[model samples]
Target: MVDVLEAGGWGLLAGSALLLGAVLGYTLRIPHQVVASVMAFGAGVLLSAVSFELALEAYDRSGMLPLVLGTVAGAAAYTAGNVLLARRGARHRKRSGQVRGRSQPSEGQQAGSGLALALGALLDGVPESAVIGLGTAEGGAVSAVTVAAVFISNVPEGLSSSAGMRGAGRGKGYVFGLWGSIAAASMVAAAVGSAVAGALPASAVAAVTAVAAGAILTMVADTMIPEAFEEAHQAVGLIVVAGFLVSFALSRA
Candidate 1:
């Protein structure tokens, strides 16, 4: 119970960034380049965490088979969900409604996009938060690197998505409500992850961890990187590398 509470707290702490970003996006007029740069950095951080913390840890725990199978399964699952959501007008859920060469979504497209965007955010966030609980179940301190990575990444997610929502004509109430619900859900996800991982065997835990890594990696490649490079161009690579190095150093430390 105590561990679960701790996991919830950490998950909320991480997830809270989404609300903060939403507030910023709704209130302020941030530049696309800035948003792109931050998104790239967050993507890099998540990539590093997936590589060093999740996939490697899973490999160390139960060897190669579980890791490979779990990762493939996770990637496939996320891809399928993404496809379904895309068809519902969430294909550009991560955009700020202002793609460089693309026109904004029409009223008909925006009509159903709010729900799809919210669901898409949930899909991206749950697995990441679950891994926090999984870390806690390992009998020591929770992984700070994981928490930090998720927090950093979530800020841009909320910022960009909320900005897009606003562009799509969503009201402030809707924007805040959407992010608030997701934040609360993240807390529940972390607690549930802790509880479930606590009951699972080592091999099972390894598989689950690998699954999250795979999904996150796919998200980065499909959603984050393209958005990051959309505006920032060459410099986004440097920022990504810097973010990756920072996360890698934290993991090593």
Candidate 2:
């Protein structure tokens, strides 16, 4: 089971990397509104998967108390880190406000947007990968399915990164860097998840899973939902429901 899970996990991780590359290499050409809708749907599927599969499994394996504590701890830690990053970004944006308004950037500022994009991808990459890795480590039954689910969830992320680059008027090479950063982070997360899985208690894993789910849920509601709505598309709710059904169906089968 471990061997099967590991193999499936690696495949999923690689698939995620490929999906990201495809987005950078090709999918960015799609319209922004369409992209936003797909992203929202993906987010809904992923958030639901994490809650129903990973967190719930952890709780069943461990206990409710551990799950609750771990979720809180995970949320608190991520929240703190996010807050810090936001503050730093705000400060930097303030200092660079004059430059942003300009038509062109100085040499030092030229790569700033790409750099920021890479940094954001780096922050998100590890955790996303870890979640996938954990899903696989839990067993063969969920391994391949988890990977596919995450791959779909990540489509929007890759799109968002690419869109940011395009909007910033950055080159294709710079956009590709964002995907590369995410792939690299996924690799790191897979390594970490595999290594730690053997030593961690079920409770610890459950807690982390809960925390991850919460963050992902927040992202879906705050970012993806808003983006999906801005496109004047009324089909978003249906798409979201469809995405959830797809994720659930895949997991069950």
Candidate 3:
């Protein structure tokens, strides 16, 4: 149907942001301050997206029960999985430059580390991509704030992850291919989310929205905020504020 195609189009538009970030990460030597600034800004934008878009939307439609359960489950799931990966020496996922962890993993550990990073990246993209679907479901439109938050944050994440993968000795071909695949998968999830979103009941909507909200909040708190602060220190707070302002302005516009 036309709606499906439209949803697919929106999904591709949003997913392309991550691909752009990946390309930047692989090809350029972006400065750490620049990376930190983008991360902080992205975090702020995501905070707003969570508050106004996800939480408020769920509360308005389905009340608090689904919201609570969904949020808690999402946060818990992401935290547990991320912690497990971190323990496996893949914790430097948000590094601005090279991973500060083990530079020379045994040949065996290299693939493991790469896989962990890839999984982590996938987890990061899911909620954001789902958000694109939420917008399309409502009106076949996408939220600019959601797109901005996901896109901006992915720049630093891609930079760091790509750098870490290379440091782990992953080939360039493999690196691009991995990111390209993830981008494609995210686009598909968004498109499917759009196509099916209208069919879901209120409770299902609440669960899905709240779950995405919870996972994003946890991921930002765990990974993005800390990395932003680490890279930019006191300035990171201001950058976050600026990001919020910019996103707000865009939303209003």
Candidate 4:
């Protein structure tokens, strides 16, 4: 139990690095195009990591059914969660009479965006934290790799999250709220990881890989890439590719 707590604490601390990034993003005065490029690059790296490292390795270590099923399960879980949130968000907007008309974002729209970002993080964090906790419990070379991959993938995610908040024009309160919620998700993940240690170790890694990949891909293609183009000219595409390569290198390292 003590070990589990310690692992959870570590996982939460690591996840909180994301929040720190959000605060730093406030100071950096990041351009929208830059954010897009970074997000795209990060997405590429995440995709590569999930495909080459997490998914492939898990299958190698375990077998076909567990790997495939786990991957599908992870994707399904993410889809279901997002679908539910979309419905809820729509309803929330409808109730408040807020989401009507053009998407130019009226004054309070930012608040909605902040809430949306927080909601997304909360949904994503559980499995992530769980993976970290399980890695720590394993306590060996494998643990090191798992922790490192998760840590790497998390950096861009944190920064991108903050970027989302800023883009939405969320105030400091919302910024902190989003960050706090994401941190809490890390803790949730840790709890889930602890619980799954014995029951479904092998499948968990594969599932997480798939889910993270899908989410990251959607975010880059849909949100970040578009934001980048909106902020600057087409020249930024090169920069975006460079960022992707940099992240890929780090992931490999």
Highest-TM-score candidate: 1
lDDT of 4 by residue, 82-178 (tens): 5665554411221112222525444344345445545666666666566566655554223444444455445545554555456556687767766
Worst 10 residues of 1 by lDDT: 91-100
Report residue 216 deviation for candidate 4 (angstroms): 4.5
Worst 10 residues of 4 by lDDT: 90-99
Question: Model 2 segments beyond 4 Å from truth?
Answer: 1-28, 77-118, 138-142
> How high is the lDDT of residue 244 in model 4?
54
Cα error of candidate 2 at position 36, Å: 1.6
The root-mean-square deviation over C-alpha atoms between each candidate and the true structure, in angstroms, is: 1.9, 5.3, 2.7, 5.5
Q: Considering only N, C-alpha and C atoms within 3 Å, which residue pairs clash in candidate 4?
A: 129-189, 129-190, 130-189
TM-score comparison, 1 vs 4, better candidate: 1
Score residue 126 of candidate 2 by CA lDDT: 63
User: Worst ten-residue run, lDDT, model 2?
Assistant: 90-99
lDDT against the true structure, per candidate, is 0.83, 0.58, 0.75, 0.56
Go through the candidates in order and give the clash count of each.
0, 1, 0, 3
Model 3 Cα lDDT, one tens digit per residue, 1-253: 5666666666666666656766776677777778788889988888887887788887887999999998898899889988888877675444333444535445445445556766776886776686677677886567877777777766666666666566566788888888878788777777788878888898888888888889888988987888788769979999888888877777778
Q: Which is superior by lDDT, 1 or 4?
A: 1
Model 1 residue 185 lDDT score: 87
Worst 10 residues of 3 by lDDT: 93-102
